[model samples]
Target: MTVPVADDWRPRLSPGLVLRHDRARETDVLLMPERIVVLHGQASTVLELCDGTRTVPDIVAVLAARFPRAPVGDDVGVFLERTRKEGWTR
Candidate 1:
């Protein structure tokens, strides 16, 4: 799968953490260091896939099934980079 990553950073899920979202309330799954990372629709979908067990590509593949419109390749690279840089995942 592709991560739809951008930027130059990569993110990982902290061992003690899990992504939990409240769609009805619009709450987001936030990572440490950074707080209140409100996921916006598809971005949330991507972040949810950052389980650390999967590689960047794995995320993209999973997401591709849902968001066929997402940009692949470099696009995923950018997303990974930005998320990591923000210190969101791990």
Candidate 2:
């Protein structure tokens, strides 16, 4: 993953993929062409916000609002970089 400077629109969930939260199963799932990704914790929250409309910095802002005490910007930025590299997001 390339290092981002917060201003770049680095990643969003791939358009072909589908993200769903199964309440009964208590899981966050990403459905791909050949496999499914079961996300947890921060991954779940981050992916839930990756609707192609939010940039990395925008995501960080949203998460920060939800988690006021945590240092969400850096962490979310790093997670987004990984997700972008992983091909789960574009």
Candidate 3:
């Protein structure tokens, strides 16, 4: 089987915000009352970074610099994987 690249499964983005919708988390699911408040910080930042110019690695790099306390390389990789699978990129 072929290996997957970090940006492999995600859709293409033109511009603007890309929202993350989670099925299990009612807060992240659209129309839910909580409305992603629990993930208001990092997760939102992750989603917003999916611009055309920034690859998955670039996104991680920028966030890493911005948030020294946050997990960078592997963490952003995982989050991007999930976001890609969930069709959040496009």
Candidate 4:
């Protein structure tokens, strides 16, 4: 069953998955078995905070502080939910 991502959910990279920066590409990539998901925009920033500690609100707060005018709450929430559904995060 698919579980909806909650506001209190603490996200982290799934097992066996690694996030790294590809020097040649100059961007962050999610490394998994036989697959490389290239990250874009603030994706790397968002994923870095997914250390299995901070809740969704905390993540939003951090981003909001960095980009005070941006709608980080909704953006972060949607991004997290999508990543969760994609099995990249837990």
* CA displacement after TM-score superposition, residue 22 of candidate 3 (Å): 16
lDDT ranking of the models: 4, 2, 1, 3
- Candidate 4 runs further than 4 Å off: 1-4
Please give the lDDT score for candidate 1. 0.62
In the predicted model 2, the residue pairs found to clash are: none
Candidate 3, residues 1-90, lDDT tens digits: the string is 222455533334323333556667744421223333345447767766765567766777789999998667767777666655654454
lDDT of 2: 0.79
Candidate with more favorable, higher TM-score: 3 or 4: 4
lDDT against the true structure, each candidate: 0.62, 0.79, 0.58, 0.90
Clashes of 3: 1
Cα lDDT of model 1 by residue, 1-90, tens digit: 444443323357655555677576667756444454556656766776776667776766777777777665556667666766655566
TM-scores for all predictions? 0.63, 0.81, 0.58, 0.92
Q: Per-residue lDDT for 1-90 in model 4, tens only? A: 233467779999999999999999999999999999999999999999999999988988999999999888778888898998899999
Q: CA lDDT of 25 in candidate 3?
A: 71
Tell me which residue pairs clash in candidate 3.
Answer: 27-36
User: Model 1 reaches what TM-score against the true structure?
Assistant: 0.63
Question: Candidate 2: where are CA atoms >4 Å away?
Answer: 1-6
lDDT of 4 at 63: 95
Residue 34 alpha-carbon offset, candidate 2, angstroms? 1.7
